[model samples]
Target: MTSSTHPFEQEEVMAYLDGELSANRAANVAAHLRECAECAALAEQMRDVSVRLSDWSVEPAPANLTKNLEAARAEHVVAKVRKPRGFTGRLGGKFPFLRNRWVWAAASVAALLILVLRIGLPTARQESRQSEGLQLAYTEQSRSADTPESKAVGTASDNFKVRPAPPALPASRGSSPKFSSSSADGQSNPEPTAPMIARTASVSLTVKEFAPLEASVKAIAQRHNGYIASLTSNSPQDAARTLSATLRIPSAQLESAISELKQLGRVEQESQTGEEVTKEFTDRAARMKNARATEERLLDVLRNHTGQVKDILATEQEIARVRGDIEQMEADQRSLQTRVDFATVELSVQEEYKASLQGAPTATATRLHNAAVEGYRSAIESLIGLGVWALQALPTILLWAIALFAPGRWIWKRVRRTSVSQS
Candidate 1:
């Protein structure tokens, strides 16, 4: 019906009948349907059509059609499954290199060998060149020295094998510091630099006099131009007093300090160890060089940036990060240097104790109380242990019982039958 003649349009009425309209609109349509017979009749006809659609059903497909669909599906699946693969595809599914375990092992070994050679060859060549240079320098120095004093020094140099120092690595800001190889007379005096070694020593002693032991330990450290890192002293009421201290001493004076410490008491145990850290120091120095280079590049970028604020900020952030890394690495280098410069000594001293019959013994009541407490603790522990065992073994026990139940019953029944038959 036209909207001019009716309050609701035909589409609105149909939507109301289909329950698609909002609640208020649907209520108004219902009220209008109750008052207007013609609109109500039209709504009734729409509802009747919807009811017919809801009840209607399509006929099932013919049996041959179902069979034909099934056959088509099977043919498509077969075609997909039987698709031909290229040589590369087949090889990809089963790689030739993976077929034999020995091939993988051989390849791994070859790669490892190549890596070792690559890393070792350059180092070996550098060392050889350094040694040759050192030898030639020694020869020149020996020829230059003709005086008796110089001759004696030259003969001494001949007996020693001079090792050349490694090439100077790049520093953070300035050039690496150089050591003068010439004497005050401007004559070359080649002295071999020793490899860096961090020394550690442990000494145990039994002292007769405990009064001066602590002072002696401290004196030993001070004498060697070192400091006590940690010290712990325990003096029991009736037992021998003990003192333990960890000391850091100049490696040059380590032997002397250890000998002096041994004289303070009868030596019970003594041991010394050294760890070479030249390579470790070299590696860290190289890394610091690279980090400093990165920081310098970032600083340059930050200074020359004519780009957006964000780009400048990002560059500044990167510079800050690199600077932080450089500082941390510098601190690490200092710590490593300290280790090489100092030797660690672990000292333990015990005072000699003589037993005397003057001290009072433990009371009987106190001993009885301790015994009772220990007994209670033992009983509780035993109970806890039993509970734990049961918890751990219950499942296994139940499983075995279930598994053996049937066979056990069969065996019992056969035994009873045999006994009855014999009776």
Candidate 2:
């Protein structure tokens, strides 16, 4: 009848002592404790501990605490009796007119209008002004006559003629070239420049042979007075050979060049593109002309004017800036001219693939020997691959083992201790 001989666990006895069990279970435990001397002694020890704990008491609250508690209870009751105020109600308390829905709606509308006026209107106006200015500038430049030097170099209207240059013009400060049509004699009407276009083409072809086709492509480029910009060719034993190249041809000869290139093989895909850069070219030319004019005027000032050291230095600096601008614009103009003169042709040639079926049959013995050799080689390769993989994974495996073992060991110890204690 002792606790050590009873069927119930110590936890059940403790729960009964704490009155946590149902009445029937508590009664059963009480009967068992009366019969079991060990359980009765354990219950007496727990009761003693509880009695000792009860002796420790907190001090009584002050008189002010009682007044505050009563005040808080009264305020809580008042809060429950009154209607709760939401966000709009609190906002209306701060601004009485906001209580009106019509007033709130009107204020929202005013804020939206102010936002549109402050942000949207200015942005629209700025874009409109910029567009207008660009249009006007383009129109003026297009109507202006090309400089004699530009004409010799080949105007955008012309097919980029690389002719010999004429004699240079005298740098006269007294006479400056004008952007608009205005002469000492009269304002003559200006001729419009032609539209400029940069042309490009791409052609994909399937050829019977790569070597002959490649040679023909090079010959065709040479015949057209064009050159190959780049060439890439690859040939694999198990796959079809391929050749890709970029060719630069004269814009005037672009059509004829593409036609000739298509003759090397059957054309699978072909595309031609042309981009108009008339406005851009005109803008650059106009800027260059203006810079040159500025440089001429500065040079005249340096030649004719007498000034102090600072003034001369400042004048020289301005001249240097104008000269730099002129050079940069000239380079841009040349690049644009080159693009307009030379058209790009991207060409790809693929060899038509054919599978071969001509091979001598091997003897059965030889075939068996080859198979065995191949199997052995594969097995060896597999083992080597496994070894390499293990080498690569060893560090990660070790790291994970170290990380898991410490926590695993701690948990195992804790479980073992719990098991021993329960036993």
lDDT by residue for model 2 (281-387), tens: 66775566556656665677578766667767877888888788877766675576667656789999999998777577988999999999999999999999999
Per-prediction TM-score to the true structure, in the order listed? 0.43, 0.45
Q: Write the per-residue lDDT of candidate 1 for residues 14-101, one digit (tens) a residue.
A: 9998799999999999999999998999988988888899888878878999899889879775444443365323322334343355
RMSD list, candidates in order: 23.5, 23.0
Q: Where does model 2 exceed 4 Å of error?
A: 1-192, 357-423
Off by over 4 Å in 1: 1-193, 361-423
User: lDDT of all predictions, in order shown?
Assistant: 0.66, 0.66
Worst 10 residues of 2 by lDDT: 169-178
